[model samples]
Target: MKALRVLLLLSLVAGSGAAAEPAADTGREPFVFQSDRIDFDRERNLVAATGDVELAREGRILRADRIVLDRNTGIARADGNVTLIEPDGEVLFADSVELTDDLRDGFVEQFKARLGTGSRLAASSGQLQGGTRAELNQAVYSACEPCADDPSKAPVWQVKARRVTHDRVEQQVTYRDAVLEMWGVPVLYSPYLSHPDPDVTRKSGFLTPTVGHRSDLGVRIETPWFWNIGPDQDATFIPIVASQRGFIGAGEYRQLFDRGRLELSGSLATLDKKPKERARSGPRGHLRLKGESHAGDDWRLRGEFYRASDDGYLDLVGLDSSETLPSFAEAEGFFDRAYARVGVFDVQELRSGVSGDTSPLAGPELLYEWQDAPSPDGAGRRPAAGAALHRRREDENQRVTLEGGWRLERFTDGGHRLEVGAGLRGDFAHGDGAADDNNTRLLPQASAGWSYLLAGGMEDLQMTIEPRAQVVLGRNSADADEFPMEDNRAVEFEFDNLFALNRFPGLDGAETGQRIDYGVQTSLHGAGDWHVDAGIGQSQRRKANRDAPEDSGLDTAVSDIVGRVGLTAGEMTALGYRFRLDKDDLTARQTALDLSVNLDPLYFDARYARAVGVPDPQKPPGPAQDKEEREQVDVGLGSKLDANWSVLSRYRRDLDTGRSLLGGLGLKYEDECLLFEAAFEREYKVAGGDPDNRVSVRLVFRDLGSLPGTQGVLPGGRR
Candidate 1:
């Protein structure tokens, strides 16, 4: 039963406008009261409400079985299932409560609160002071979700504190004499602990700690502290302690500005003593520094510097496994159709019998590139130009190289293509007790090719078959043996590079004789989300370069046959294979295969690669190229057993030696408010090296602050 009722009582009170209005009245606001049954005692200046009583003002609501309000004293007493909801959507429930005039200061017994972070707080007794502070005695807090199947079951994790204080204005919570409980068992305790409210974006605090064991470092632990300098800047400091090694410290700092951001991180340590000779030798500790920055919208900078106190320092400390660290700094910029970059690079040797003087260094490297838009004349021709300067140490001599080139390509309507390119490069050699001299060479190249697409296959299938041929000519017939090989050493023969003027990746080494490159390719596109592509190619050198790598597939008149095949089935599976076979015997010289599949709860991937060994033809052979074949296989799997549990595993093995290289297994569990994971792994360092074992564990509690309450219809209360 409901009725429309309105009461407007206007009375001039002492030093105020209207008596029936709120205390801080703006004269425009009104004070309304409603209940199932309302009765006023004029003699006592008191109002009593029963039967689902409710009082709402300024977005704040108070509901209880019964409530009594004294107009003169401005105090409200609520009994029987009392609930108070704040304007910010927070809710509190208590058996009984007494609130002051402004509803700011109050006391509650057998109370519980639900915060916005999904965490809950329950206390035997609580006090609200000044509307911005709350004090709870003998309280329990938990972020874990209770079992919906059984309301009587306890949460997975919780924290009990003798006393807790929450400061709404500062957005922080502090606990004293706190105990951390897992699965209803107390596992950790602290005298004092504090954290910013979940609503806080950044605050100073201690992050989770990590503990692990390594063969060289033994048992080790790392604790990190985070500091928020400002809204755009922050830093973290981590201190590491190990039983076998001394203390080490690592830190990282980052800042954001209007134009760009900067980040710098590093780690340093001091050794206890020299390790035994039988152990991995080299540095006693490691040093690593890295930084990156961006300026404006078109410019960027990056740098990396890493070094080890000894050969085993990095691997033992679990920082990195490489024995050689290359340090470099580069800056790059982009324009409308042009790009420019400059950098300096050097290498650090941490291995035994390696000297710094023997390692090469590039003091300064510069490059620029530009491209012209397609010709408006409809020839579909594009012109591109590039230039570079490199100063580095090569073969105990100081070498300097300056080079530039331009290429023009024209495409015809009949699928015909023509390319013309020319370049002039010079090299100046000096220092290292070598005769100062300059070697200049001019390179001119041209190629032509034609292709046709033959469509209309079986059942809406389309097929394309294309055969292409190209010929490249150079001015110098010296095979580039006179110029020091600074950058281009390893060359891979593939269909993509079949018609290339130079198979080498860089300008250091150039192909110097006439050559004919040709290939045939076919592709099939089916209607049922299936496709197949395959190609076979080879190169023939009219004049051979005896100085080239023997198995590089480019030194003989008839190079090895390079072929590739790829197949895909929409989004479910894919497979690809590439191989280089000997021209005479058709024996595989280099081969690789990759396969992947994704089907709901099951996923898998596998890769295998084998590179045959062949002795270096140019250098006096110490270790034959095929002395130890490079063959390995890698595979991984992931399966979701149910809604909250998943299993994952990965493995890598040396197929030739039948030895396990690396393997790991992991299990993970996650629910609404909690996540847990554990993993075990084994890693084999290098040839003849023993295996290293490792284990890791992690846990996360989501929605760290929340509370429970009954259903309500207030403007901002739970729906």
Candidate 2:
């Protein structure tokens, strides 16, 4: 309504170059007025402007054919072609309006307005009440552009109500007997509807609802209510009713403090009877909590807690799509070039054949690390160090381990690059159910590397070829097999770790004896913003490490050849490939490829990974047999058919088993006044059941609330 004052003032003073002096005794700012003819009614104490008159006050203006003002009564009337201009450049139109001198109390006929948010409002008649509220007899509103050809035609969508009230004091709009119309046809009706105006960002109300169908949960419907408790805190509660699972309640609470933020979300449901009549399956649910804050100058604190009533609860009720639930809490601190962290974690093993009793809970793990960045002077050296203490609790056994390590390295370049590095690590272990209850091992290692780069290519196509070699010396620990391997389970042989000081990933496993790691890498920077890089490396060990799985490519005297290739052309395309080949037969042991192409309307992304299982060392060695194998592929496609329509598809498949893991297809349409989406998806082996088929649809009207019915698609949490 403030716009009304500005618009009216603009129309009243458009041609008045300067404001007229105020009355001698009024003690008020002067009013600017312009007109073809102005008459002063001395006897009646009235001023009248006729024929293309304009009036302005402050920064507002109003133009009308005739304007009449009664100085004594403090009433103003504007008739014929009335237009008001606001300071923010908003213009309002009305057939005629009457208001007091304060520009608060007013009445408008045939009023049409365009708000700053691109929304449109029209009223048959309106009454200004209490200087802060406006009531309209009959009104219609939309956030759509009217058709230039036929303004009378209905917009894509609109809301029509018998009585509409705008309460400026509350920043809210309320409607009575409201009807939601699409193409002029009423599709939904409600006795009352209210929402925060465009200016209000948060308000308490009923949010959109979700409707879906599942094999286990049957027909699912969830309606969520939002409570805006305060400027920094809010909560949403959703009550779900399913034909198969009965009623379930879920909610999320979030709050932002001066220095941190916290959030919690979860769901609970009660079943009439458990499927397969499992013991203790009456009620199921899951909860997750997360919080982060600054502790001090260089330290930060964070914590997380997640738990599930049962392994199948999430999958059965569609809360979490994963079969595993991991819960943990941690705290961390940071310093210049150094950091420390402590954490405790527990995993709920819901999968069959897995016993939670045997799974150890990480009671408390303390770790510290410090590393210096590469020398900025190009001639300096630095040392890095780390330490850790881990305690785990199994069924009847408790284990404690302490470990520490340090690495020092120096690098220099003079025609050929040279690097010298040394590392030392020690481990102390004391535990109950192990071959060696108490044990200690010390490892010392040293390595030297040299690399030469040959750069010579055409002016437009520059290329570089580099060959590097490193020889590492270490003594094998005879008691390595007597210790328990708790943290580390698998080793990855990739180009990124090809030249690492140690081939094993964790402290529990370390390589020993003499070894030579050599590789040559080449790079090409050609025309058209294109670049290509490739590298291959292999390791030759003086002694075989039978402790490593055969498929790990590190169990033999000669390690498998590992290589990687990367290609990119600006933002439009990217491709990467990494693989390990058998040292003797050159057979692929593990391979992965990732690629993405963004070519305008045509976009594609894909990833494929395959690995041959390693041979089990516990079994006798005769003919090497694969102990495990995995192959999977993921692909996505997106296309914009036109300005208002788009299509998307995604697929995940297990190539080894020739099975489709997950697939989805979606279509979207959007225009000036309407947005529509429809999606269908299938999730296989999720929640430990058959493939779950789901279909969801959504329609949102610009100004009015959206037609709330869709599956609760958790943002960023894909099954």
- Candidate 2, position 653, lDDT: 88
User: What are the lDDT scores of the predictions, listed in order?
Assistant: 0.69, 0.72
Per-residue lDDT over 647-672 for candidate 2, one digit per residue giving the tens place of the 0 to 100 score: 88889988877878888887888897
Give me the candidate number with maximum lDDT: 2
lDDT by residue (tens digit), candidate 1, 377-444: 32222222222223333444444545555566676787666555555455454344334444544555
Candidate 2 lDDT (Cα, whole model)?
0.72
TM per candidate comes to 0.82, 0.85
Best candidate (score: TM-score): 2
Q: What's the true lDDT of residue 153 in model 2?
A: 93
Q: How close is candidate 1 to the true structure, as a TM-score?
A: 0.82
